[model samples]
Every structure is written in C-alpha cells, then in structure tokens.
Target: MSQIVTLQAFLDHWAGSDPEKAAIASTVRTIAGTGVGIADLVARGPLEEGLARIHGSDPNGGGDTQKELDVIAEEAICAALREAPVAYLASEESEDLIALNPKGQLVVAVDPLDGSSNIDTNVSVGTIYSILPFTEADRDNPNAAVMKPGTNQLAAGFLAYGPATILVSSLGNGTQVFVYDRESSEFIMARDQVEIPVETREYGVNQSNMRHWDEAMSGWIKDCLAGKEGPRGKDFNMRWVGSMVADAFRIFTRGGVYVYSSDKRKGYENGRLRLIYEAFPIAMLTEQAGGGATDGKTRILDITPHHIHQRIPLVFGSKGEVEKIASYY
Candidate 1:
C-alpha cells in the first residue's frame, strides 16, 4: 500500500506538478481552508448563549429555517475564500452573489451548513461547495458566471460533519476522501479513488412526500415498496435521514439510490434542492465516484441554471439504479 499523506501535502504535490494551473492550486487551498473552518465549527457544537441557536427568520427566503451555525459557517467560508483567487462567492444563506476579488479567475458556490435543521436533534449536517471558472465578461456579471451548467464545474466537494468530520472532493478527477485528524490538526487522506457500487438493494427517498409525487415517481416507489413480490425481484431497504449530506455520505460509503424528486406540490415543480450549490456539487461528486446523477429526464450536470437559487429534482447513486430511475421518466 502507498503511504498515507496529509491533505495539504497531497494538494501541494498536485499544485507543484501543475504550476501553470494557478486556479487549481488556489481552489485546493481555498477548499482546505474552508474545510478546516467548518470542522472547527462542528467541533465546537451549538453555542446556546450566542448566535448559534436557530434563527427566528430566514433572511434568504429559501423557505428553510436558518440556524445560527448556518450564518457562522457562511461567514467563516467567505472569510477564507476572500484571500483565495475567487472572484465571486454564492451561498445558500445570502440573497445575492457577493464579489470577493474582481480579478480572480474562479467563482465558488456553497451550501454553508446543509441540513442545518438536524443541528437541534444532533443529527449529521455538512458543507457543500462547487468551484467554476469565470471569464472577463463574467467580472461585472456574477450571475452569468454562476448560472453555468454543472458540467462547467472545475471542482466540487462536501464536508460531512458526523461522528467524524470527513471531506470528499474531486478536482475533475476521481473522488477522494479525507478524515480530520484532530490530534495533528490536519486532514489525513482516508481513501483515494473511491467508487460507488454499480448495483445495490438500498434506496433513500422522502416517503412523506409520496402523496405529492407525480405518476412516474410514485410508480417507482410503489415498485420498491412491493419488494420481492413485485417486478423488482428483490427486497430493498428504505432510508431517509432528512439530510442530503448524510444521505450522500452513506451512498458514498456503501451503495444506494437517493432521490429528491419533483412532486405535484405547488412550489415543488422543479424540486427543493438548489441547482447550483446543492445539486451541482453533489452531482459532480456522484459522477466522479462512478455513480450517476440526473433529474429522471436528463443528466444533472447537463442542466443549465437560470438563477443562483434555482431548484431541481435530484436522483443519484449506483449507476444501475440511477439508470433505472431515468427509464421511468
């Protein structure tokens, strides 16, 4: 086996080997910096005396209630990226894109504290991010740059803060994972070239929204519910953590299908997850791990963004299962 190395050393080696790709190096540094900050916040836990408690209102109007940690994490991530070569920072908590350095070559979108609702219950939550290149034309118009398709992403990743703070990322290469070593105060490489299984008997979906689902989506779940006696020909386990990061981490470690599809509800025509910050980054990671991500009708990465906070239906996981879901569309 090859020797394990720290995340900094690994990133430095890549940066050194590709000296001309300054954006790549900068992205690496920025992600590492943000990951550290997020991990530190996770370790500290909720600060009841301060602003760590659940906020009374969500300033962004994303529909989800914002927690104090969400604002704190966003501030920390933005602070770290401010010094990096990032031209713009788009976040879930913010109502608009914030410009950092106009001359910078990259734009970053982030979900500062995903699944923040779980914070009160001590359930796992995380941070998700995507890095994209920006052109000279994009300097004055951050929205134009941020609205690019997920296929334009240069890099993407997520930090799952559970029993262990884990960082999984892809730099247009295969997905890799690192675990935070608290004693050494560094992220140590845990697994390199991680790939999801092609098939599995596990699945995740918000069954509570079954009544609102469209025919295609409802039919798929019906079959899964039928289990061995149905056409699927096997028993399948159902799981729902009400946390995308936690669900994604579980799929990464094992093999399972996760779906957050569009239902017939009034505001859910396009789904609930943000296309840029949530769906795009997770789709990139899924593809990197040999899995697949889609909206049942088209590849997730192929969908173009109309706005920063545009929502989309997300169905991703084991390649075979994802394909199966696509067939139903």
Candidate 2:
C-alpha cells in the first residue's frame, strides 16, 4: 500500500501553540488510485500530459519553450487543485478567481508555470502560490472578499521544478525548505528558518524593455549601471532570468531587487506580473523572508487584486533597493 499523508495533518504538525494560525503546507501524498507523486508532479508533468494530447507525441517530440510549456502546465495544475480544500483559487492562467470549496477557510493563488519561456533553454522555472484566510465574517459576496491584497496572505510558497524539484515556503514564523522525496513521494523538511542576507547588492531586471520604460525606471537603471561610481557607492550586479518565480527564488535565497515595470507599450500598461497569483505569492514570501515587494510606488501586499488575473508592475527585494525604486516612482 502507498503511504498516505494529508495536507491537513502536515499543517497541524507545522502549526505549534498558535493553533488558530491558518496556513498552507506542501504535502506530497499520492493521488488516490493513481499512486502518482503529487510533489514530484509539477507543471512539467502536466505539461507533458497536455502536450501529449495536443501533439499526440511525447514532450520531447520537439523543443518547447517556457511559454508553450506553461500553457499546458497551467491547465494541469488547475485541474489537480480542483478538489483541494480551498475557498477560491486564482492563477496566472485564468481570467478570474475560481471558487473551489466555498466554505473553505483559505484562498489559494497560483502561478502554474513561471519562467516558461526559459524552459526550452533548460532554465529554472517553477510555481508560486499565496494562501489567505477566507473567514465567513469577511463578507457575503465572494468577489469583494477575495479582492484582498497579498499582504493578507496567511502563507506563501513556491515549487522549483529544476534539476531538483524543491518546495520552499513559510507560514509567518519563518521560511522552510523541502525536498521532493520521489521514493516516498512526499516533501520532507530539508531546511528550516532559512534566512536571506540583506547586504547583497545583486539586482534583477529585464533590460530588453529599456526603451519602453518610463523616465523614472530609465533613471533608476542608469544609476545602477553607474555602480560604485553612481549615487550608491556600492557595486551592483544585474540578473534577469526572464522568470518571475526563478528571479523571486533568487531574491528569496539571496538578497536582491527584481523589477517588472510598466512600460510604454500599449498592451503592457499595468505590467507583466499577475497580481493575484504570481506577484501576490512572491510578495508574501518576500516579506516573510524580511524583504519587501511593491509596484514601484505602492506596496504590493496593500494593493488588492482588482481583477482575477490583474497584471501589475513588481519591484521587490532588499529593503534599500526596493525603497530606492519606489522613491523614483
């Protein structure tokens, strides 16, 4: 018989004296009847399944990019969570927050596939999520209640489907890292109370959109370019992996700033990051790790998701750099 582990049990074990604390934990229980690994099966596995349906061949039939793989992966991840005990589910793949367990206490926001454009290149891609408490006393209308910001999240985490599929997350106390035990098909605690050094001067930003950036953004990049010769006397290293989850993971582990700003492009008026799923989850995780997240000017957690798949500019990381970006805005 396959070993069974319940998410609820995991949560209870993780939750200490603060029993009222509502949070989410990554559990790798086998799917009933299928015996397929839950933790091991991220967007890639689902992407393979979806691609099989579309191509009638294996995922290796042709070289696939992250964007293409993401489309397939999003569908699979959403489908997997259909029966999860969540109140409302939001994702970068959907146009709105999906109602799952209406009476459930938590709302889940997910990015089924992030940095998918990097997949063809074998770059690190992953999934991000935020969990918020949905109390009945909040409101009767589902839309109004779920419009809360990322700041309201009770827990947040990410799954890095890389050379080693790992899950990193926190429920307010501190950050925790877990490894996907393929044999046991469960997430075993790998690291606890993980910390990110604040003094690191690394920064992440997409330079391709430099031409479309606003004056403030342009000015900020110029300053960073000046490095030790500029307003900030410290040297700065720039990193842009083209994947929000991957970039955010970098910031989460090592201190750095990441920006996805609103450009002059017509379609990119707001920004590229999805507010509910991608940005919200990363914002929560960042804050929990003693970092900051913002929309250049306003704090990311304070901004509610106006729309289900609302896209917004994101600037987060070391407090100093993030604040500098906000100052420009």
Clashes of each: 0, 3
Best by lDDT: 1
CA lDDT of each candidate?
0.86, 0.67
lDDT of 1 by residue, 1-329 (tens): 28868878877776676643566667766776677766666666655434357675756775777777888888888888878888889999899988887667888899999988777666888999998888888876778988878999988999888888889888877899988888998888888888999998999998999999989999988998899999898999998899899999999999899999998887798798999999999999999999999999999999998878888899999999999988888
Superposed on all Cα atoms, the candidates' RMSDs to the truth, in angstroms, are 1.7, 6.2
Q: TM-scores of the models, in the given order?
A: 0.95, 0.80
What TM-score would candidate 2 get against the native? 0.80
Candidate 1: regions farther than 4 A off = 17-20, 46-52, 56-58
Output the lDDT of residue 66, model 1. Answer: 76
Among all candidates shown, the one with the greatest TM-score: 1
Q: Write the residue-wise lDDT of candidate 2 on 1-329 in tens digits.
A: 15443334455676655534532442222111111232234435445454323222223222222354455555655555555555676656555567776556666666766765555465667777777776777546666555886667777777787766667777777776666666775556666666666656788887988999999999988887888889977788988888776777677777888988999887588886778777777777777777788998888889967676667898888887888888987
